[model samples]
Target: EYRLTNPPKPPATVEVMDGENRKHTLQVQVLGAEETWHTPSLLLASVGSSGGKVVFSQIRTLDPTEDVKQYGSTLNRNKICDIAFYQKVHLEVDPGQYESEETKFQALQKSDKARLEILQDLLSSHLGLSVAEKQGPLPAYTPGYFLGRHELKLDFLSALQPRLKADNILKLNLLSLQFCGKGVEPSKPTASLMPVFLHACPQRFSTVEYFENLHSEHIGRLLIFSEVMTSSMEGLDGAVLHHGLAVVACQQISGAGRSGNAWLSPEGCGMFSLQLHIRSDSYLGHHVPFLQHVVSLAVVLAICSQAGHEDVDLHLKWPNDIYVGDCIKVGGLVVKTIVDNTMTVCNIGVGMNLDNNVPTTCINALLRELKLAPLSLEKFLALVFTKLEKLLVTLEKGSSGVDQVRQLYYKYWLHSNCEVTVIGPQGSKQEVTILGIDDFGFLQVLAKDGCAFSVHPDGNSFDMLRGLIAPKVK
Candidate 1:
């Protein structure tokens, strides 16, 4: 059986040629089919340009062979996936079956790999020391605590309330580092120690320098790392830097995506994870799933807040994907939460192609096209935090705050009033119109026959290309 993630529109006309060279034309509207089918059969295909003609040839004879079970299994394997294109493009091959084109493609691949290496080098150089040297004992240069003057750290300790002050926030930072160390690969012992470290930070910093009205404790504590297995795993268990610790990385070797998928993390990608602590009885606690929505809104609003970026057409995909200019994803969010008796520690991981171009387009690439200055990573992050800080306040205000967020989400989302086909676990299908998100962040849709229901983001995968909502196979 063929499952078309992007199926052709209705009124698809098919032309068939008989063995006697006779031809017949038929118009077909494919609605449904068997969920699974197995058979060795000949397949015919065609390629063409958009708004152009495509023709398929007739098969003179039919033959059945043993099923290629290995090929099917390989296709079903769970692995990292990347989006490279929004629409199909046909390639014109030269006489030698594009031998020259193949050679050029190989050269381009090498060039991309080399570019990524250079970016990695730049990230290391940003710290003014090599990874190997930093790992060595008594390294020539080691960042001081909080990368600040000792007196400033003392001042921050005194300013905190007695309870948090006694807890010792600096000690918590050390515990986070130790937690990360245990999770690193045994082969790369230095990876745990050298790359990740505390940088310039203060418990109470002035956001007036960047943006205003943001009163956040942990969000501004920047933890810069050269590389890591994944930012999501850092400071996860144990004493996490919870007021809102920002863990930024140059690159993630194995970044995370929704449903255990892999996120491609190379240099030029703005990869980070924010760890925040909230009360279980708070307004946010009841809507834990909406954290991704909050982050998603913060990203687009952050970018648009800049002077020249006010007109940048950034949008949020359902749940937590960020898209720029027609289905080209530029960023995404993955959230994880651990709940205690009365508090919830949430980790929000974000990966954005701010300057990277591999897999798909980046934000800077779009800026360059618009003749606008590219955004600096530092300022962009500050804006996101500012927007997030403000949005979080709304969540803290109860249902009214959630309604405000939902209203703003609808303003920037791509699926408002969108028509999609929802496929059920039993191979059932229904056409639904997306209304908005519910209180719990699940997609609220109105199906035909005047039925209304919500689709849980975790249970269904939304394929915007073909407007499909299918069960998420674990």
Candidate 2:
């Protein structure tokens, strides 16, 4: 009966020297079967030596064979040892005797090192930043850097901190510093710096309280203006040039609402705020600026749709809001245009409640209902800029530019066929059938009296329409 036993462990090293002083050492361990067997015999033979001379080692066996005649014999002759078993026992040279295999392995290692260095150089050059290597209990591959030119705003840092920490490969947080040219400046009473910008809201704080709460130490010179202006400040520029910065605020105009803010800089970059508040009880003015703002927003939505593998169904509500479903507001865009004698600069603020759901009336709430992952603020901001840049370039060409924006707006407006109620001046409510938006980006509504009046000629008429308390149906 045949029985299985564990094979002997192979030798660790095998080497051969020159012909005269060649040495061979074999170390092997075998676990034999427990059962007692008949006497076992072992035979050893070597052929094809360097000089073609046969070399044989003495046979060793657990028990001596009684029938052993000569070195060569035919099979079935127990008395004579057969040469067939040992005739062709030629020991071949080790397969790895040549240096080709070692050479290939070394070459592969060198190539891998070179490839990694190239990738690291490319990454550093593309980011225009240097990464500092870190050593600690943290991940070995984490890279860290200090950010220049741009400081992290409070809101941005709050949202980004957690995500960066969660990535096991990122060890250190990015540090941001202000753009101060090389070398420290000398203290001087008259030296002043140009302001960058500021943002504040009056409804959130009164003018006196706002100024008092300004964290003066961090305020720098640039001041942002919001809804705290009155007629008393007319023709008076509130900017104060001090220590390489400018401090400025808005001129509170009469009839302007209590919310919204402005950004001011000495470089002539100014932005105003237009806030839209909609609740279950009220939808205020369908303003002209608001429509233009919504058009800018739609351009962003179009780009996002193209980027995703599946097309997202995105559309706009008349006047100033974006909606994805039955009367649900998903996102909003605020446009503050500062027009001076020289130029008009519009600062567009887009706020999207990516993950939050407002069940009663919000676009974010609808997104949750569809079971889609919330959009990240960083990705959304990047896409918005890309889309805005394209739209602004197109708009610079004149009236033709406006026409293109109008076309895109009309294509995305969801309720163009529904009856829309227009609230005219002084509490007058006019229910008109929706026709379409005109070239000037105005809502062309056909009144019940057979008159077609442009609801928002310059974009301000929507304010009246939005103020009505009840939804007007056809």
lDDT per residue for candidate 1 within 42-82, as digits (tens), equals 12222222222222212122111112233544443222011
For candidate 1, what is the lDDT? 0.61
Query: Per-residue alpha-carbon lDDT of model 2 for 219-273, expressed as tens digits?
Result: 1112223222221112112211121121122222231211343211111111122
- Model 1 residue runs over 4 Å out of place are 1-218, 222-224, 227-232, 237-239
What alpha-carbon RMSD in Å does predicted model 1 have with respect to the real structure? 14.7
Best by lDDT: 1
If scored against the real structure, what TM-score would every candidate get? 0.61, 0.37
lDDT of 1 at 259: 83
Q: For model 1, what is the error of residue 136's alpha carbon versus the real structure, in angstroms, after optimal superposition?
A: 24
- What lDDT would each prediction earn against the true structure? 0.61, 0.36
